[model samples]
Target: MSDIQSYKQTPKYETFSYLPEMNADQVRRQIAYCIAQGWNPAVEHSEKENAFGHYWYMWKLPLFGEQSVDAVLAEIEACHREYPNQMVRFVAYDNYAQSQGMAFVVYRGR
Candidate 1:
């Protein structure tokens, strides 16, 4: 198996929930807003009814040298405040599972 497959058992992600009816325009705007705040956009994927049954967006922010989880969560909270309609969730996993990472915001379609 591939290295990634070998690590498949590892729990490397966390999820956040958002309105499931957001349109593409709104999703794009939210992503742009997050980027403006200095957070890096790592992955973007779409899901159909057969998949997640809704559409969503996921982002990642780098935790530079010794940054605390609370600090990162605060940044994510700030983004949510900036976008009232958007819901953001931040999760920090143990190093054994994954390094410092976040789910950021997930815009679900209504």
Candidate 2:
């Protein structure tokens, strides 16, 4: 799906929701960049229409440590398939420091 043109108009009670940081074409490269930097990728989703409704619901998932890019790609693909209607995200974690590096709100519904 394309980015939400307007967040408040699209879903939630929030007055504003940030725009997507990564466009479609940039996804793979950005994921690869995060992996190259040794960050682990994980997925999460919010079921509400205004995703922030009831507070940005998220999945409690394990980190993908030292996983191959293919594995990460496969997991991301799975996330898209699993949560086709909800808002999903791909977040990279720096396990060494145990903190988030970066994240991309998924745009590909395929």
- Top model number, TM-score: 2
Instruction: Give the whole-model CA lDDT for all candidates, comma-separated.
Output: 0.40, 0.64
List, residue by residue over 1-110, the lDDT tens digit for candidate 1: 13232224532223323223335455455545544444443433233232233444443444433234344445554555554454444433334445434443343222
RMSD of 1: 13.7
> Which pairs clash inside model 1?
19-108, 20-108, 20-109, 20-110, 21-109, 21-110, 22-109
TM-score of each: 0.31, 0.63
How displaced is residue 81 in candidate 1, in Å?
A: 2.2
Candidate 2 matches the true fold with a TM-score of 0.63
Query: Model 2 over residues 5-92: C-alpha lDDT tens digits?
Result: 6556643332223544556557778778888988977777666455544454445564556457666666666766777877677778
Worst 10 residues of 2 by lDDT: 10-19
Reference-based lDDT, residue 91, model 2 = 78
